[model samples]
Target: MTKIAVLGAGSWGTALANTAAENGHDVRLWTHNLNQVEEINQQHTNSKYLPHATLVDTLVATNDMFLAIENVEIVLSVVPTKAVREVAKKLATALEEQAHTVILAHATKGLEQGSYKRISEMIAEEVPEAYRSALVVISGPSHAEDVIKHDLTAVSIGSSDESAAKLLQKALSNETFRAYTNHDLLGSELFAALKNIVAIASGALIGLGYGVNAQAALLTRSLVEMRDLGAAMGAKPETLYELAGIGDLIVTGMSPNSRNYRAGLGLGKGKSLQQVTEEMGMVIEGVNTTKAVYDFSKMYHVDMPITSAVYQVLYENKPLRTAVADLMARPLKSED
Candidate 1:
């Protein structure tokens, strides 16, 4: 069994830690929250984020960043996008000696706003460049709750290093969980990050009492937008059709449990962005990703009418009806 370290005590992190333990690895889950560490260690539960089930008895929790990093062969980072750099800096500081020996897999999905860099690129910047060679992106449609329940799930392990991706596949793959490898690291992360924006759009439709037709339209258009933006950013066009793309978009857009979807529902119900954020209490990644993608779309000269509409509604305080009208009035173009 390999030694696995999971940073972040959030639902996804806890669930992944459980998966690693169930895979018979020695699991060390790290969090900044001492109370959460204590809860995981004492009660085998992460009450705030994942209250539905208990963790494996073999799973270990620690507030010490070094303890979490020390001796682990692979580190899985499941923190939010914004925290990726800060956590990597901390990990870097803690693992000056062990950096080369470890493989780092980041599961968070979002782009850095100004740089428009994928999270993998952000990690490449924050962590030592030498360690960047070992960086891999772990992503798919697997939700934390479903994964913990042992529902069948598949993920893509993207890296320039095929061996590193294969290593993760061996470490993470199981009867209920499978891992696929790809060299499209940036493309994988791009769709994964951008889809949350579309999910918010879907939730907004539901909140606005739009029917399935509206949801379907939103999903289709968003897929196009996602592909267009990804293409502009150097991602393969076909990558948008894969699990990290259409597959992820479908699940997040439809599920009530999706934090971004719930946030969009609030907007659809006529709540302010601040109000929705306050109510969710969890990080609604779509809010930030929408802002990032808006800038990206403009910078890349990509046409994303649906994303533009949502951005206007959220940031410019344009009425939802007005945004819809604006979208409807856009010039017609080929559906290619």
Candidate 2:
């Protein structure tokens, strides 16, 4: 069985570790929280994150960062986007001899603000350059809650190296869990990061009591805008229509469990962004990705009207209805 190191104890991380263990892989699920480590090791559960879920008996959890990376061939990074670089750096220092020994697969789905660097870029900066070529990103419409329940899911795996992607495809795929491989790492990552912004916009529409038509229009337009921006940024145009883009957009925007969409709902219901974020108690990725998209659009000179309007509503205290009106009033352009 493959040895897997999951570098997070959140719901997604726990779910993936459980999946690996159930597939008969040895997993060392690492968390910064010692109490969570104890919960997984002693009780075989992560009640805080996955309340109704049970961990596989072979799954181990630990707070010792070094122990988590020891002799593992696959390092699955499931931490938040903001913490990715810091965690990767720590992993690098802790596993110097094993630097190029393990394959790093990350599932974070947001861009770095100001720099607009994707998670893979951040991982490349933190990990040794020799090992950077082995970095991979796994993304799709799968939600942590659903995945923990073993619900059927399809995910995409992308990497610069075709062999690495194929390896992950074999390691993570099952009859219920389907995996597809692509060499368009940048496109996959770009879609994963940008889809969150569209989800926020979709959520805002729902919160405003707008009907399905408006949500559908916003989602379609936002996706086209994402492709336009991704094209300018060297991504494959066709990738935006695939799982990482359209697939993730549909699920995250419409699903009630999406924290990003829920945060937008609160904003649409007249709650301040600060209040919504404070209540969520988790990182609403779209909030952070909004700023990233705003900056990236300017950097790429792509006209993303919806993203701009959503950002203004969230960050500039612009009223949601007013922003919608502004977007609607913009000059019409050819739908080329």
Candidate 3:
């Protein structure tokens, strides 16, 4: 059995850890919360994050960061975007003297707030070559709640190192869980980050009482935006349309299970950003990614109107309906 260390205990992290454990892997699910360590060990449930979901008995949880990674074959980084650097730095210290390189697979999706760097870039900055053989991104439409239930889930795993992706693919795939290996690492990561913005826009439109037609339009147009931006940023064309891009976008935007979509819904229903966040009690990737993508668009001259609208609604206090109006009134261009 492969030894797997999951560096986070949130819903997604816990769910993934459970999957590896059920597959008979030696898995260590780590969380900074000591109380969480006790809960997962004694109760096999993470009520704080996945109240309705039950974890496997073998999926052990830990509070000690170093212990989790000791002699593990795979390290899954599932923490939020803000914690990526801190976690990597700590892991680097832990793996400093390690002779063997561990595969670093990140499921966290979003860009750094100011620099707009992706999670892999952040991990590379802190976790040097001696620690990790490669950085793999495991991302797609899979939701934590559904995954824990063993509902059919398909995800794309991409890495600069193809062998690492294949290794992780075999480690993660099962009857209910399917993983496809991808070579377009940049495209996979770019769409994974940008799609959250579209989800916010989708949720906002729905919250504003718009119908399915509007959602169809938003999905289509926002895809164009995602594609154009990804293209300019060196993403592969097909990757933007594959499971990592459109697949994830559809699920996150359509499902109420998505925190980013729910956040947009709250804003659309006239709740302030603070109120929405306080109500959700979790980090909404779209909210943070919105600001980063908005800034990156300007700096790179990528035209992203919907993302700008989301930024305005979330940060500038622009009315949801007003933002929608502005989008509808934008000068029409060729669909090419």
Best by lDDT: 3
Worst 10 residues of 3 by lDDT: 92-101
Candidates by lDDT, descending order: 3, 1, 2
The C-alpha lDDT values of all candidates are 0.85, 0.85, 0.90
Global fold similarity of model 2 (TM-score): 0.96
- Candidate 2 versus truth, CA RMSD in Å, comes to 1.4
Kindly list the per-residue Cα lDDT of model 3 for residues 1-336, writing each as its tens digit. Answer: 899999999999999899989988999998999999999999999999999777899988998878898999899999999999999888888888555579999999898888889999999999888778888999899999999999999999988789999988888889999999899888888899998998888888888899889988999889988987887889999998789999999999888999998988888788888999999999998888989888878877988898899899888988889989999999988988
TM-score of 3: 0.98
Residue 185 displacement in candidate 3 (angstroms): 1.7
lDDT (tens digit, per residue) of candidate 2 on 1-336: 888899999988888888878888888999999888888999998987788888788999998878998888889999998899889988888778655467888988888866778998888888886654488998889888899888999988988888888877777787778888887889989888888887777777888899799988888888778888989999887777788778888888778677888888887778888888898888888888888888888988999998899889877988899999999999888888
lDDT score for residue 36 of model 3: 93
Ranked by lDDT, the better of candidates 1 and 2 is 1
Global Cα lDDT for candidate 1: 0.85
> What's the lDDT for candidate 3?
0.90
